[model samples]
Target chain A: MLTPLTVALAVAALALAAWCGHAAYRDQPTKDWHFAGMAVVTALSVLQLVVGVVRLARGEEPADSTVIFVSYLVGVVCCMPAVGLLSLSERTRWGSLTVVAGAVVLAVLQVRLYDIWEGVGA
Target chain B: MPERNGDTDGSTGTARAAGTTGDGGRRLASGPGRLLVTLYGIFTVGAASRSLYQLSTRFDEAPLAYVLSAVAAVVYAFITVALVRGGEGARRAALACCGAELLGVLTVGTWTLVEPSAFPDATVWSDYGMGYLFIPLVLPVTGLLWLRRQPTDGSERTDTTSRTGTTGRTDGTGPAGR
Candidate 1:
């Protein structure tokens, strides 16, 4: 659950980042399709979050502190929606750039999530 | 590959923005300012939440680091608000805050370097924000430059014209309209 799910989520996140990066490069706003892409990544994160929370409920615990581990899990799920709302309000090239920032943050959070779960950097 | 239909009626982007402001014009939260706001908003949330969690759960482990993270979150929140407000007063406030933020980063960064034991846990500005890819160090400088480029009260018209004309150059890519 940990390794494969993190990989899938990080890949989805980076894919959204690349899509938004192209939009930023072309100096365009985040279009409907970009939102669609974010939706995909976000839905996957929601699934990941459910699985994580269920595991914790069942008696599974992360290698690190459960507090920060749960925080990272929750953080991944919120990133896309927050950026989506933000980019929607702006409606400019910077809006697309905002997506890029959010997606990159999401990706990095994925890595940190895995690290926290595995106690790699702890 | 190029999708150009990003704006609706695109004609009013620059003109509408320019006309709406009061005597002191030039929105700092325009083109690049939007990106800055997004980044700052993220940092505000991230740092604030992390610090609160750390302070609540493990105050005994590293009080100094958590306090610094809380301070970083406050500064980020201030800058995010200033950018979103988009007025002369807000711009100056952001500018002053950016300077203070840079000073904080430098002070914390050097202190951590000189005395690593003081920070058993990491603060946001530890070693110049290396934990966060040095973005904490770079962000203040970027905010400073962006705020400085904005037109103040008396120099509104000419500053707007010149910068908007060449804004794309400074921006790397994108229209001057924001």
Candidate 2:
């Protein structure tokens, strides 16, 4: 895994989570700005996905189970979009809260991916 | 839909009736319940995939742990579906699932703490879901609370009557009364 990219994704996800958390606490619905923030995070994840696939093509395999590593890579890319759609349907403070939860989950997944990758390489 | 129906007198009575059913039972996916559903959905996917992968690839290493994870996945999936499909029956089913989930988490959590050697690997509820920020432990508690807040079967009549009274009086105010 790309260490810098993973760290960047985790940081971005957590920042978005905190922002959405504050909005939810204030009883606000998810706004266009929230979507924009999500887009940025999703873009980062997509980039990571592309880079990860390229690395795999170059025969740079993680030390752990390749299946698990691939699954996490794909899952990291899917998380934001899925949560964004779910939040869009909700249209309430709870919708914002959902985004907050999703972002935090993404951050956690990123950390886990890093750990798993490190485990294999080490 | 209720908001639109509240505009027409002809539809008001029917809409009010429907609203009573809705508000009384409180659609499991409404408001805060939506958040619960989303979280449960995440857990269902997370636990199910994790358990399935572990069971398929290395079950011999930790059969008990993988099996427990699979069980948690099934329970999460059931609760997620029940919450999304709101009704008297769905509410009851969700309530039962939440209760079972709470018990499972507590039991497994304590067992892991007491006999760490028993689990060669961590299940979803191990250490009270410490690995997942304890959300696994807290989820069922919140789910039970949310399910309890739904009007009971016996109290449906009273709930509908109270809801009808409020909606009936605020006809001109539109859906704002809701």
Q: Which digits, one per residue and each the tens of the lDDT, describe model 2 over residues B9-54?
A: 2243234333455344545675677789989999999999999999
Clashes of each: 0, 0
- Candidate 1: clashing pairs of residues: none
The CAPRI quality class of candidate 2 comes to acceptable
* Candidate 2 vs. true structure, TM-score: 0.83
Local distance difference test values of all predictions, in order = 0.80, 0.80
- Per-residue CA lDDT of model 1 for A1-122, tens digit only, reads 46798898888888888888887777677778898999999998888889988889999988888888788878888899988877776666677788889989998998888888777887
Report the poorest 10 consecutive residues by lDDT, candidate 1 chain A.
Answer: A86-95
Per-residue lDDT for B15-78 in model 1, tens only?
5335454544335766677678888988998999999989998999999999999999999999
What's the lDDT of the predicted structure labeled candidate 1? 0.80
TM-score for each prediction? 0.86, 0.83
Worst 10 residues of 1 chain B by lDDT: B160-169
